[model samples]
Target: MSAALRADPLADDTIAAILAGYGGSQWEAIALVNRLLAQWQSNADVQGWQAPDGTPAPIAAALQAYLAAAATLPAWADAARIERAEELFFDMSMLSCSLLFCASLPECYVVPDLAGVLHVAGQLEAHCDYRVRSTAAMIFPVMMKGGLASPQGGGIAQILKVRLIHATIRHLIVRGNPAQAAGAAVPALDAPCRHLYDTLYNHGWDVPANGLPCNQEELAYTLLTFHYIFLRGLRRLGLGLAPQDEEAYLHAWNVVGHVLGIEDGLLTHDMAQAEASFAALQARGRQSPFLPDPRPALGAALMRAMQDQIPLRLLKPFPVLLTRYLCGDAARIDLALDQRVNLLSRALFGAGMGLARAIDSVVRLALPGFSICRMMTRIVGYQFTVKFLMNQTRPLKLPPALLNQVGHTVRAWGDDPKAPRWMNALEARLAGRKARRAAPGGQPC
Candidate 1:
């Protein structure tokens, strides 16, 4: 094992390797591996799965148990936090697998049971649209209801629309690559992929300018969400990016991040600024329904459940994918992607709220014991490591080297890991310095 994996034994790389060696459904394996980890961590005296010196057994053995438990994981063992964390890991892993795809030729295919894949896609499509529309209904609600309110209520709706556009386009595109992109000899499925990209590129332009009923504060926050989504999607598809396209996307993304009140430091480190800005806007003066701090309550609940003895699942999607997707099966890719969209949507919008309510509910569901602050810390740490340790220690810029690394890692996760890359590569290209030159002046997209 590499020192990186050994030092940070729970590093995404190690976890991914562990998952790959085990044979089980991705989600089931996730649950089992985590459960075993918690068990091992808590008891140094254990053997079998435990090492002779009290450390956990070889990573591969733990992975085997995780896979073995797949057939037997209790139906009643639904830990909400664990499930949520696994879902996020699953999403990141799926993306990583695609980014790491290194084959010069297209991968050959084994036709999967399209029924399960398509069914999941259908359910997710319906779920995402419902959430988007529900949030849409909240815009200018009093006016829509013919009640007493000014025009500004609609601004929240518009911001939500832009976010929904992002969420939808991303999920659709990510779902596209592995199954259809790999197998299709024709363009029928590719049309939706192209359309989704077009939608993201065009619709996102309006978010920063929408005459929402908020001060500069809320507007900046809204813009940041849109911009981050754009950047993130683009960064994932590194190798696929064309030289000409790189600079434009990068410039637009960075400028937008700047305009949305993101300081270079905060953008580089503490990313909660965007979310914080959103909260400030929501709570401009008096209390707003759009704002609440759920961490304390969620933490309390988690403590109660664990009796302060167990480690809950980590919501690190990228690591989990690394473990699961190392083998070259495409079906696993489809399964992971399907689960990711469904889980995010359900967690975000499973509650019956209109679009605005869905947003609020998602925020609520995500934050309960979820620790955005901790997540923010980890994100900053990861970026810093990438910059320094990875010799990417320069100012934020897209590098082909970075892209190549991401592609290889992603392919390790699953079969259809293409959409995230496609979207991300475009974003990365736009993020490149060349794209910046293409524009007469640096401007937000």
Candidate 2:
């Protein structure tokens, strides 16, 4: 690695920004750390609770060791970097959820307040709109339908239409940015966004409904949209998963690829191949197998949640209440369901309630003294995988040198471009490229 690349990206300014994101959230961080540690303690408690008498002692020992490793890693070691990532990711999650929620509302025929909604667009100052638009698209469907309790507002079709509208506005906003450098301008967005607006305005809500008959195709297009978002997020932040965790990262990437119908030959580990590999491992008992069990239950649960027609059933009263309190709106109650059934049935929906119940079950199953850490890790990973897969991000191959430099700079500045180095090199290169084109005179190809 070049010297610049080898330097830690979490230099001074970056650390400051990172520290700021988590400053007031220390209690949460400490609780998380404690929870991770307690998960190990739960394991020891497990031997006494659930483990069979014949189960090997090594299982507990291995888990203990992993927890120890996690705990001993200094909280501040890469504190800023992690916090910055979490901050952006958490914000994006909330924003995307809010956008979908609003779009789901009966009154929001076409989502409005473009300037307010697109404020996060400023986060993409470093990347192009195509990249931004794509990411937004992929995430749109999932976020719209995700973790919801309602059926009518949460269907994939409604989600797609809302996403298309959001994408159209996002494109227009980019094209209309007066501050964008000439070299960085994305003129192509103007036509497409306008075309989509016209389509939606002229034809009403029937465009995507009539156009995309296949659910998988709709899923694929939406996935493509958010792929760009994830890419832009990663790019703008100058972040990459640690190389040591390549397998884990690739697994997450492949999950999204599967949903998108993109064949990358990475995630195609079929049943036969899986069985063959399992047979080759002459390891311990069946329950204690060496291979990590793949998570299919999550996909099933997510699909179920999307098809849920009511929100009150899916989310806890606290979240619903909090959402209303923050937004200054009255909590929406399902009077129709209540009158037919009872008051108790009004607050919860099938899928949201189902997911909450399942999550609780899994957590409890992992409790009584152990496996909570593993469960939490697994849950966090799946959430990330789902989010990542649903993202509109894509891969862009930069010159290795440039990648390293940007990565290093991000590490230092906490991935904020407001710091000095981000635009310095990019501006110089863009200027150089512009000069070369301009030297050839008018309309240089």
lDDT of 2 by residue, 1-445 (tens): 2110111111111222222334344234223323332322211232222323432344333333322332122222233332333334332332333222221221111111211122222322222233333443333222222201122211122232232233233223333211121123232222232333332222211111111111222223233223322332222222323332322222333344442223233232333332232222211112221111111221122223332322334322222332222222211221011113233433433343345445544654543222222222222222222333223253222223323332332223211122123222333342222212222233211
* TM-scores, each model vs. reference: 0.18, 0.20
lDDT of 1 by residue, 1-445 (tens): 2110111111223344544555664345445544443332111112233323432344556444432332121232223422332333333432321222211000101111111121122232333322222322221121121111112122222222233222233223232211122222221232232332333222211111211112223324334433333223323222222322333333333333332223333332223443364334323321221112222222222122221211223332322232122222342342232234335434432231134333433554543322222222223223212322223332212124323433343333321122323333343342221111222432222
Count clashing residue pairs per candidate: 46, 44
Q: What C-alpha lDDT do the candidate models reach, one value each? A: 0.28, 0.27
Model 2 gets an lDDT of 0.27
User: Model 1 residue 201 lDDT?
Assistant: 23
Show model 1 residue runs off by greater than 4 Å.
1-127, 130-216, 223-256, 259-278, 285-412, 415-445
Candidate 2 ranges with C-alpha deviation above 4 Å = 1-83, 87-326, 330-342, 346-445
